[model samples]
Target: GLGPEECMAVNPRLVYGRMTGWGQSGPLAPRAGHDTNYAAVSGALWGCSPADARPVSPFAVLGDIGGGAMYLMTGLLSGIVQARATGRGTVVDAAIVDGSAHMLNLMLSARQSGLVADVRGQSIHDSAPFYDTYVCADGHYVTVGAIEPQFYTLLLQVLGLAEDPDFTGSQWDKAAWPVRRARLAALFLAQPRAHWQALLEPTDACFGVVLSPVEAAQHPHMRARDVYSERQGVLQAAPAPRFDGAAYEPGEACAPGAHTQSVMEGLGQSGARAVWRQR
Candidate 1:
């Protein structure tokens, strides 16, 4: 197979970007793996699920796109800038395991500050009563992340629990978390998700209702910003991070290899068309 060395031999200033689940020279480099495998080895999957539950894989978001594609793009861009300045290229070995582990730096910092714990279900994110998801009477879910005292106070006030003795104590008291969680769960379960949404969505309780993709598309904020669009009967997300607040219009989707001939011609490799057609 043609590799970076061969490509760089042809063009000394070409940026060579490689993506893999492990790495090019590691023991597991040649092993077949996927997003979950990479994230598992990187320790990013451990804190994802609740304590005693199976670690839930976040589809391809964690390893494939977040760790693999994004890092590769960044490396390629940086390599381009350096190559233009130094008249030499570099290889970007973007391994999912490496990028995923690097993404945990924020969590590592939190751990040092005592906001996170080594044990599962013991951290503020996973264990706090005010920070987890609750099931409503309609079987739908709502999430809260009132970690700060002010937000927690607002949450308790909206829930009519501000004066309750069980919650008037220190918010970080681990001993009281279990009982508080149970109470909050019961309270939420007594009302439908919409009811809580109406009561808390306007406040600074740091609250939100769990929404599906289709539902999210219909959300007021999303609709106002045109976050999702439909083309040829297919729903897709619009280009993000708009430039100068200008919306980007996406082109129609094309079939695989739709522009292969044009690309080959542009690269002065028109003769390769015949070779590719023979296959």
Candidate 2:
């Protein structure tokens, strides 16, 4: 059990945290890679999309935050709680591959149960048309998750397609989806996005407009909630999970070695001036 000062050069009650994709001291550890590279190596990247289409990257959320940082945070919080109770330090090494693979546990169980198809594109999760995106008017798009019969019925009603017998009846009919999707696509194309938004936002319909990043930032609801702020002429993301009494500072770009003096002072180490003089 190493002391906090030994690991961090400060009496931090520190939970020493380490995060990497290939893990420390492995064959791929020294090799440079990003979240996509890590995901590619792990089985997590495979079969995320159609077989003919390019594989979806699953974004950085998978390997970076979801796999690495999140686990580290969990471990660190656990260590912090333990240390608060019984005065001890802990080290957390969060490996992205391990975390990423661990996340596939449920999928593996389903596969083993014979519920998941061995073929990638043919699988229910990948092939289902109801749980997908659709093109809209004004060259925009909307996501539709009418997975259940009731929700799908609501979708058809919102689109004013109640009279279309092609969309009625069974929800899981795969062959019928393409026909219904084409019909819905044409129907959605007949009106502008504002029309659909005005109609659908008030209902239980599982439909949403695909807003661009900039559009989302300026969305009236988001602006009203103050979800983002401008700082130093930069649009910085706001601190999340707001608390009732907690205050937050706007994020800023920190220079390398900017906190060196303050950190050393807090650690009771030699001052920057002293180090420069020694050199």
Candidate 3:
């Protein structure tokens, strides 16, 4: 049964299964919008980029997957475990806004400590060019995550800039990050992604190619791990959280009325299709 227009009363396990961005019922819950809009309302999308342009769309993954459905699913599972142990079931109120706010706990701490500015892309991790993406010669991109001293050293070494005076002198000193980042950006632009990958993949330098969506599915590492599969001419995601010593299978899709008879009988309602036909 549905609850209060926005909420719904289902199995505590299933109640934990529903997903939405604005969540079941908040001030903005009834408003219809997409992930970007939903994220904006929950402080998940404020000044998320450079001050010059519109916000980038990172897809529905943030609101729908991260804040909404995934957390609900997790809560549901946890609730099931709790109920089994306590012999009591309860409802789960999964609100995307609440979840999204919870997701910002790290940043909240930073903010409270005055470490993070009230501005976006101004902090060390967000604004620091030392850990960001750069375009490559092949129209692709590469990520440089030289966040720490050792990793940054590995980056300089692999880039053949080991002999550069600034490479070792003032790394991680904040002031030098801009200069180092500029140098690294230029160096990355000079080579294709594959060239950098070949050199850095074996080293401690945390470098990687910024692959396209299609490239991710057939990537060598993903294929080696069997991270995805195809069935009945449809590409379906693999089941997550593999069972402990048990096999898992996806339920078959059934038509809407496929279980109507069974459900009605279970509910003690008398509406058998065969009996109706006899009348």
After superposition, candidate 3 runs with Cα above 4 Å error? 1-18, 47-52, 110-115, 243-279
The per-residue C-alpha lDDT of model 1 at residue 274 equals 85
Candidate 3 global CA lDDT score: 0.70
lDDT (tens digit, per residue) of candidate 2 on 1-279: 354347655655667877888887678888888787777677788866666787778744688877778877888899899779877767777888878788878878878765467777655566656666666677787767776778878877877777778867576777786677677778778777777778886787887778865676787776766766776667765676679944465657677777777888787875665785576
The candidate scoring highest on lDDT is 1
| Every model's TM-score | 0.93, 0.79, 0.77
Give me the displacement of residue 132 in model 2, in angstroms.
0.8
In model 2, the worst 10-residue window by lDDT is 1-10
TM-score, cand. 1: 0.93
Which pairs of residues clash in candidate 2, taking residues 3 or more apart in a chain or in different chains? none
Q: Least lDDT summed over 10 consecutive residues: which range in candidate 3?
A: 4-13
Better of 1 and 3 by TM-score: 1
Ranking by lDDT: 1, 2, 3
Query: Model 2: residues >4 Å from true position, as ranges?
Result: 1-14, 25-27, 47-51, 58-61, 105-116, 123-125, 245-257, 270-279
